[model samples]
Target: MDLKSTVASIVDWPIEGVIFRDLTTLMKNPEALRESCDIFYERYKDKNIDKVVGIDARGFVFGAVLAYKLGVGFIPVRKKGKLPADTIEESYSLEYGSGTLEMHKDSLDVGDKVVIVDDLIATGGTAGATVNLVKKLGAEIVECAFLIELPDLKGRERLNGCKMFAMMEFDGE
Candidate 1:
């Protein structure tokens, strides 16, 4: 299936000259949702991922399922103050503004293998911040995965050379 077609695009959302790639359309479709999960599962099933760290909100949707399918732990990288525990935070810049992400300090152990997951990668601020949090905890990142990528935004450059994968690309649109 062409997963890119499953996404809904909203123009000038949250600001002018910004296009939001909404995955809700894809999630609502049973076949699309299953296929999306299956794609990630097939790729990482044997990769020895000790944990699947999901970015706040959207990332949780696919990350939890992948963690279960791989039989590993699911760690949530939440927005600041959302996690009710001792947490570490990393701040990042967005197209319109700035925000912070937090994760529990005990979410991972030193040398644990991890794969970060998110719904989309635009400017990569969220993904990059999440990467820092993972590194601070001393977990080895296997790769960062996403459902959609906007290559035109050059988000990949912010990842500090960590390996990345996206199910589909919607670039130069």
Candidate 2:
């Protein structure tokens, strides 16, 4: 499916000088949504992933189902104070300022293989922060997966030391 067609772009949303490529349109289309999940499942089905960790909010949409298809576990790395019980958090820089993300302290184990998923990779701040949190548990990162990638932002640079996969890339949007 041409997933890009199902995406809608909004200029200067939530902030000026930024164009947000929204995926809600694609998500609502059953064919597009299924294709999106199928793409991720195909890549990781044989990777022996022990867990699928998703960033907060939108990431949850894709990450949870992918974990189910892979027959593994799903973990959510949410905004600070979002998770109950004892948690480990990491702070990272964003385009505007900074933010903190947290994950349950006991969600992972040493040497466990994990795949991080998110709706998109923009500046890579959130994704990178999640990666660091996973590392604290000594889990091996199988790869970082995303449905869309904006290459102009150099987000992947911050994702060094981790393999990344994106279904599609939007440049000069």
Candidate 3:
């Protein structure tokens, strides 16, 4: 399936000059969603993942299911204060300013192998921050996975030394 076509392109979304690749369209299609999940599952089944840490919002959609399929725990890395329990926070740079993400302090055990998941990798800022949070908690970051990647942005540069995977790529903005 052409997952890109399933994604709806919204011009000037969230801000001018920004094109948002909305996954809600793709997620609504049963076959596309299933295939996408299956691809991730098949690719990482042998990676010895102890936990799947999903970024807030979109990541939750596939992360939970992927964790379940892998028979591993699903941990959530949410926006500031979104998690009710005691949390550890990491603030990182954004295009305009800074944003904060949080995860429960007890989400992962020391030396646990964790995989971070998100819907897209545009600039890699959020993914990098999530990795830092995982490190701070003493977990081993096995890899970072995404459904789409904006190659022209060079987001992968920020993730040096980290294993990164994306199902689809788009070069042009």
Highest lDDT scorer: 1
- Candidate order by decreasing TM-score: 1, 2, 3
TM-score of each: 0.98, 0.97, 0.95
RMSD of each: 0.7, 0.9, 1.2
lDDT of each: 0.94, 0.92, 0.88
For candidate 1, write residues 1-173 as lDDT tens digits. 88778899899987889988889999999999999999999999989999999998999999999999999999999989899999999999977788999999999999999999999998999999999999999999999999998999889999989999999999768
Q: Which sections of candidate 1 miss by over 4 Å? A: none
| Colliding pairs, model 3 | none
Residue range with the least summed lDDT across 10 consecutive positions in model 1 = 1-10
lDDT of each residue in 63-97, candidate 3, tens digit only: 99899999999999998978899999988775435
Candidate 3 Cα outliers beyond 4 Å, as residue runs: none
Query: Model 2 clash pairs?
Result: none
Model 2 lDDT, residue 99, Cα = 95
User: What are the per-residue Cα lDDT tens digits for candidate 2 across 61-144?
Assistant: 999999999999999999998888899999988665689999999999999999999999988899999999999989999999
